[model samples]
Target: MGKLIVHPDYQGNGIGTALLKEIEKDNSGLRQELFTSDQSLRNLRLYKRLGFVQFKIKPLSKDLNLVFMEKKPGLLEI
Candidate 1:
């Protein structure tokens, strides 16, 4: 449950990666989940590379879909 946002003028400089790394560093051994629009392909790829897998997808509106993803780090899946 965290938010990471870098101003449009400051993007593409690894700010988002740094933020996620720091958060994941202080919070290990627990499953982490996040939600984003299906249209966010960049975010989808980033999450996948970070070990998150699609947990579910639910319709948000007639023109958009929401994607739910989760990562367990080094923990076992129940």
Candidate 2:
């Protein structure tokens, strides 16, 4: 698991892509997972493009939706 944060000024600069690729390359035998709110449509699209798929969706509050996503390199499912 990892957390990546990008400043508004750094958006669309590929920083997040670089970090995600590096982490995926360095980790083996373990699937990666992350969560985001429904509001982050850009992030949601980016994550899906990287092969992460939504496994769960839970409500955290009346105005917020939590989406749990996961990615696996092999046949193993989590």
Candidate 3:
């Protein structure tokens, strides 16, 4: 799942979460990875709540960085 985009007007309506869930169902038992801009705190929080862990942060430039997160809900090990 690339970018789960819900228009600004649809924000807070669970649309993005639903989309992510569907993709997760399709991928069933695989680990998924995605990146968001460092400044997007809202998205970061949502991803974290969905069980994604921030494994690294890549600096894109002097003022921008990418937050790389991953999730493997089916995995039983830490």
Per-residue C-alpha lDDT of model 1 across residues 1-78, encoded as one tens digit per residue: 566677889877888777777777888977789988999887887778777899999998998999999988794332
* lDDT string, candidate 2, 1-78, tens digits: 556888989989998877877888798657889999999998998888877899999998999998999998763322
TM-score of 3: 0.87
How big is the RMSD of model 1? 3.5
Point to the candidate with the largest TM-score.
Answer: 3
Which stretch of 10 consecutive residues in model 1 shows the poorest summed lDDT? 69-78
Candidate 2 wrong stretches, greater than 4 Å: 75-78
Clashing pairs in 1: none
Candidate 2: pairs in clash: none
Please identify model 1 stretches exceeding 4 Å from their true place.
75-78
Tell me the tens digit of each residue's lDDT in model 3 across 26-63.
99888899999999988988888778889999999999
Q: lDDT of candidate 1? A: 0.81
Candidate 3 versus truth, CA RMSD in Å, comes to: 2.7
Model 3: clashing residue pairs?
none
